[model samples]
Target chain A: ATTRIFGQARFTCLILFYVLFYGTYLVSGALVFSALEAPIENQIRLDLIRAKQDFLVRHPDVLDDDLESLLDEVVRASNHGVSASRNVTGGPNWSFGQSLFFSSTVVTTIGYGHVTPLSQPGKLFCMIYALLGIPLTLVLLSALVERLLLPATALLRSLNAALGHLYRPFTIRLVHLTIIVTTFLVFFLVVPAGIFAYLEPEWDFLDSFYYCFISLTTVGLGDYIPGDSPGQPYRPFYKIATIFYLITGLTFLMLTLTVFYDIPQLNLSSVFSSIKLDED
Target chain B: ATTRIFGQARFTCLILFYVLFYGTYLVSGALVFSALEAPIENQIRLDLIRAKQDFLVRHPDVLDDDLESLLDEVVRASNHGVSASRNVTGGPNWSFGQSLFFSSTVVTTIGYGHVTPLSQPGKLFCMIYALLGIPLTLVLLSALVERLLLPATALLRSLNAALGHLYRPFTIRLVHLTIIVTTFLVFFLVVPAGIFAYLEPEWDFLDSFYYCFISLTTVGLGDYIPGDSPGQPYRPFYKIATIFYLITGLTFLMLTLTVFYDIPQLNLSSVFSSIKLDED
Candidate 1:
């Protein structure tokens, strides 16, 4: 009874700690993002204003209101992923290949939103598709992770056999986790990022790495989708490759997280939930 | 040994079935979206072209190429969520409130890319922020769900007692899940969507519902973010309200899923994994 009471107290403390930690993290992020991006945003806004003024100066016959209306149309169209500019290239956004990629992104919850469903039916269907697809994807990923854990378990067993006399179990498990993390970073993040950087015309190593990180985490801010550049060759194939890469990368990420959570001392979430479940 | 073999075969069959189902789902979605959206997309493309031609015809003294270049700049600026037009309203996208909304979305993994980081430092910081914040958000939600599940469990126990002589345990549990699901829809989906539709000037009921659904799923297609339309009153407060709504909605969603998976026979994913875990 005493231990249960102590456990409840600890749980309460942990929850309070987390709430404070999360608030601080979110506030600090907002402050940093506001500070770092606000200046650049202002600069971009000015540059745009200057560009419009230059256009007006260059074309003295064009009335300001006329140009403003045209710009309004252009902005409206662009917001829906339609480019009014002649310089813009690449096939339609709703082509089969692109739609396939879109479908994959939607079900996976990556949802780049570079091209969304404009039609009412499309939006309705999207909600329905996600309704079934999200759970299906979760089950598929979980089953795959279950299979993958076997080999990981075998690796741990081999490590235990070889290093039982040398190190403690927790230390050995830490080493095991380190190896998994290293392999995951190399294959999923670093190598794929290098390839993306090489293929994308504008992306540097950092941008590519950021894209990989954003994508695998499923944050998918959609600022830097691959294969969307103008006049790109084999756009469909490139998109398909990216879709495959995303799935594989996400699978490996789940595997790594599962392995990480297997270590009881390291799984902070389990620390919170385990006590409650035991109390039940 | 024979049962193990049978279990392996069943597992393989389940995997194959899911793979096929997922593939079919993706392909059909692609086809439907392509058919539904292609005509509208083509119409938009033509409209844009005709608009440009109309502008050129009206401003006969203006060079076509020069106007095209200006449009290119306009498109580029618009892609980064900046408006070159004087008619565009609302505050800058990177205001403190907007940044806080962005931060909340990122950690929750909703990641509405309506406003994203433009600077290299901003993008780098975003990646780092999401790295730590995602897990933190997960733990917080898990802890809250653990607390919420107590009342849910009590409800289930009451249902089981009342229906003990009348219905099977599964039926009682099913009733319990139905009540939970209806409550979730009313509070998180239907009511909140009504509120969003009432508040956002341009959004109809479907758009509002779609937005709520997309956001709660964390798919966050970014097509219809609220409080972003021009000249809105109390925009920051509205945005903060939306952030709170998303967090609460997501918590209830997790709670529903937990209650759903609690019923052993209803959980399809567990069927695939429980046998394997038992073999181990």
Candidate 2:
């Protein structure tokens, strides 16, 4: 009875902490985005309009017979191919903040851009390649979590054994989880975040931590992508580093999840019969 | 005890069915792609060499510009630019499949494949756009499932009520989920797939279902995007209808998830809270 009471209290506290964490980042990011919307919009709009005008002027007689003759010659030289652009399902012009938002959606796999993907090659690769990679990454992260959880689960079991007479299993597990999370933060979040800050040309320590937090959360807002930095040499190295950081960060996240998974009482996705699933 | 056995069987079946559905599509796509690879590569190589020789003869002085200037011009026309392609990631000479893959990545929001939104606008829009749409689709689907689940959940409850009083609440929920899923397939998959075949220009039933399945799963391999058929008119209607289909399909997915969510189960993500924090 005493242990059960303790377990309930621990669960409430953790839920409170998670709610607080999620609330802080989402609300703050929204506010920041709203604040900067105006300037970013202006910059993007100006560039886009200039490009559109230039395209139009350069191809002013685009519909004429002279263009037809040019098209025929180009087609003849290329052995008779047809044009494939401009039956596009276009929307209103997007702003800079909007573009960042779009990039985030794509990276996060939450693409809801009513706008269609134009161009044939662009459409085809988008399908199965992601299906292959996303699951691979998820499984790898889950595997790492399982590895990390070995020690934590052992510690949890020992704690349960030590306090068997006094405390409930639930209460013991909560303490174990808190300890594991702290360890993860120090090693995974704090340390690697520092290293990323060192490497990212544009981000300071604060910004790098922020980026790590956001990306690992699966938010994936693209305002701070690695390779886009101007004058950055070794673009591939920087890009590859970012990918490694993402995979690593995801592992720590799975570690947190494994702590949760340790409790048979809470697993929800356990569809396998040999495995007991808990309700998260 | 008998009820529990039945429930376990049901759960196993559901997981197996879902896995098989997804696995078959992916594995077959990969096999098809692998088989096509050699033939496609040869054809593409022949075309590429032909294009190169023809370009050399036609524009003999096209390479007269300095290398830096040429690179700069192409960079100016990257996909990140609003005027540039939205789905593609890289510069000129990218394969058709690469751009199609890019489109799938962007639209599905996997944003993997090591490439990313190049232009400022593309990035911003990617995030913001999903924010508005994904949740809306989720809400719609959850509502749909709620209607389907009520009777199903009640049926399980009544079945248990009639059976021995020895079974756990979890077993009842499992039976209910199975019924609901069957209903989902009949309505979401079979009926609508038949309708798509009838309405879409020149598409057979199998092709339509394949399209529906691919689009809903967000695999979007671009092998069969609608409205791309030559001589097709009223493209806007087709595009809009396709968009509606995506939104509606996504809603069903969310509805199924909500059922899972309501099961009060321990999903791995929430397993950490299995331990109550207070006693430790």
Candidate 3:
């Protein structure tokens, strides 16, 4: 009986370890795969769709080294111009500065979903890079979170003690949550949204906010990407400002959550873990 | 006094509302702008950097697409082989099916960021399309989150209350988070990662995970894309599978987090709001 129990325990431990590492990859990888094939785009289709869009929309006529080359793509029968755009950064001419920027984004986990790699070799390398990087990001955030814990816990406890008389545990938590969410919105979301609207070309209020929402979730769908906006003379400065904001914002978010979690009396993650979920 | 207070409140309310809508874009746009202009990717610089990568990597020569049109770009000062890489659908004319798929990725926010909009108009439209689509995505996620909440919350509460004696609130919450995260990974990441590795020709486990991480973050870096892995026969099935995974995975991630938050007893958005984090 003792041997059997030990064997079972060992098996469980092995499964748990496998799940811990491979499990993360599985979920994360699925997200990537699903995102990749989810909607099925053909390069040719993209060209035609853009062809129609070109006729309908009056886009800013910008002149640049990149645009100049892209124009030639349209002139050719190749779909690279509008639809079947080729991945240009790989080959014997991959850009490190670009890669640096790419690396920063990946480590930050603020992936913009733009300028994807085309080659199989490139894809393989990127995968290896991320495995190391994602954990690095987590470690960075954890350290930040640890620093934020004491004050946050004290604040939560004080708030709870003060408000406990007036409200239930659930309602008080809600109140505390409201405060956290609001703070994030005002500083991280609203102020930045305004800055972007003012700085980025042609962005109105709605567009700016949409950009922020997409970004913070780390979704990074790059439709309204900045610096692409014309008339912005301080382009690099604007870009750097964004980088600072993302790093700080994410840190703050993590910090804020850590503060909340520090309250031993007020924690809730386990509150949801026990029941069986109907994932099917 | 009331008027002044109300006016300020109204302004704050407006800003808050604006942020709820556009905050993501603001964060992503700034980073993208920064990355794009960081003295990165000048053709000369890139070639020098990638020379080793180019020589070291040995890719199977893909025989599917022709190299005829790229010669024209090569003839021009545009040294990058704009015409020769990764148009799996093939040819300049393009079919309606392919075009629709391309449009869908852009508009849907499943944006592989592989084949991007080349023309300024196309890029601009891409932005506008994402703006509209982003909210739609949020709404979809919100709805899904709401739907998934009932079971998730029940699971958390039961698990926590039962395991309450053994763990702290933090551990409980972590357990719940783990459960939901696991469910999300199994259905979205693991299975999809496996499928992507299978479909993406040369993608190994690490590469698959990287793609998932990169794509889901919305970096759309395009460094490593799917369906472009040379010589895949069933392009359409692969495309559809990729698209489905993105939609479901994204929705599930939101659900996991949202369900975590939906526990009225554990809410924390109120914390920052109470602090009047923007009082200054």
Candidate 4:
């Protein structure tokens, strides 16, 4: 009974820790993004206002407050990504190349939603595409991760052997996990972000890193899409490449997760299940 | 060797069927949503154009080609959801209630990207928030699904006992699955959709259903959002409620998937794994 009570206390502590850790993470993220984006948003607002003022000055006869308000409305619409000019010069979003790219994003559940289907047929196709694609993508990614796990497990076993005399098994496993996670971060997040930052004229490193994190986690807020910039060379090729990058990145993420879960001590599912068992 | 070949053929067939089935589902959804949204989008577009033209006509002095083009640009911006008036009147999007709602959406991977973090601090907080919130949400959802599965399995077993003499176990299981899936659809999808349709002025039943499906699947394209309408009563409360609805809806979805995966015949993971083993 004492041990059981102790176990319950530990479980509660774990829960609390989990909540606290995540809360801090979120609040910190909010603070950082607020700091970064507020200035840019303000700058954009100022530029929009200045642009409107400039246009009004050029057409002094129509410089009414109402016109200024209308101009503001128009600029706001453009910011929301509803520019008619986008439809005109931006080309068809659902073209074959773009559609394939879109399909991949939908199935993977990335769902950038930057260039969504406009027409009834396109939207219908998109839904159908996702229905099939998501499962298939899952199956494929899981298979790939399963195969990758062999090497990962082998590495863990080797680490176990290497450190058996010097460290606890959990410690060795933790070290192994750190290595795998670092590799994932370096190869997937850090490198790709650098490449993207270089390629996307508007994006700095932070934006690219943010994009990488958002997409890999499948949050896909669509705030920063690649290859949408005007005069982008080989746009289709770039999109296709990005699609491959996303697929590979997702697979690696799954692999990392698989490794993380393998370390049962760190696995929340196991901990939570044990707590449930204790409750029963 | 023959058995292995046969297994491979069967596996391929299963994959094909899965693809076809999901494709049909998505296509039908796309068709329905397309029919629903196209007219509305067109109407909005026409209205925007007409509004611009009227504004220009009222101010005959601003009737130059340049002014008309500027007006077009403004109208287009408005369409993209970037109206300055929205920022001015919509208040800060990162308010406590909205931030909580946004946090929930991010963790759940239903990143609508409608009201994204604008400041750097906000963006950083968003990333950190997602890093931890996502896994925590997953664990929570999975635990809920696991608990739900016991009753679900019990129900299936009872069905098996009731139908064992009359039908094959597979058939009984299929029936059980159909019932569970239907219940999930009715309870999570249909009912909430009805409520949403009632609440959201612009969304018809189909739109609401589409929103539910997109959200439950975690696609979250953000084409439609709730509680954004002007003069929404108890807006914060409504947003919080929607957040809960999404969480619960996702939990049910996981339950449905758990049930689906329990059926070994329909389990792609097992089939694919076996295929890998056979190849090895």
For all candidates in order, the CA lDDT equals 0.89, 0.46, 0.51, 0.72
Question: Candidate 2, residues A86-186: lDDT per residue as tens digits?
Answer: 12112111222222333223333433332222223323443444445444444445545544555676787789889877888788887787887787678
Per-residue lDDT tens digits for candidate 4, residues A1-280, read 7775576566566655755665565555445544555455455556555656777788777756767666554554344344444234444344445555556678888887765655545555666667777887788777667666767888988998889899998899889989999999999999999999999987989889999999999999988888877677888889878987898899899998888887777887776777757765
Better of 1 and 2 by lDDT: 1
Expressed as tens digits, the lDDT of each residue in B169-188 for candidate 4 is: 88998999999899989999
Per residue, candidate 3 scores C-alpha lDDT tens digits across B1-280 of 5764564465456445534433343344334433443333233334432432332232223121222222333322111112323232333211232333444454344454434433344444545555555544454444445445656777878987899999887778778888888887787777777877877766787667766766664445544556654466766566556665765677687777576665555555433333333442
Candidate 4 deviant stretches above 4 angstroms: A1-60, A63-90, A157-168, B1-82, B85-90
lDDT score, candidate 4, position B87: 35
TM-scores for chain A over all candidates: 0.92, 0.52, 0.59, 0.78
**What's the CA error at residue A151 for candidate 2, in Å?**
2.7
**DockQ (Cα-based) per candidate?**
0.77, 0.07, 0.07, 0.31
Displacement of residue A91 (Cα, Å) in model 4 is 3.6
Report candidate 4's fraction of native contacts.
Answer: 0.31
Q: Whose TM-score is greatest here?
A: 1
lDDT of 2 by residue, B44-151 (tens): 335544544554355444442321232232233322222222222222211233233333233333333222333344344434544443333233344344444545
Roughly what TM-score does model 4 have, to 2 decimal places? 0.79
Q: Give, for candidate 2 chain B, the lowest lDDT window spanning 10 residues.
A: B271-280
| Model 2, CA-based lDDT | 0.46
Model 1: residues with Cα > 4 Å off, grouped in runs: A1-17, A274-280, B1-17, B274-280
Docking class of 2: incorrect
Among all windows of ten consecutive residues in candidate 3 chain A, which has the lowest summed lDDT?
A76-85
Error of 4 at B241 (Å): 1.1
Residue-by-residue lDDT tens digits, candidate 1, B116-171? 99888998899889988998899889998887886899899899888989999988
Q: What is the lDDT of residue A13 in candidate 4?
A: 67
Scored against the true structure, residue A15 in model 3 reaches a CA lDDT of 38
Ranking by DockQ: 1, 4, 3, 2
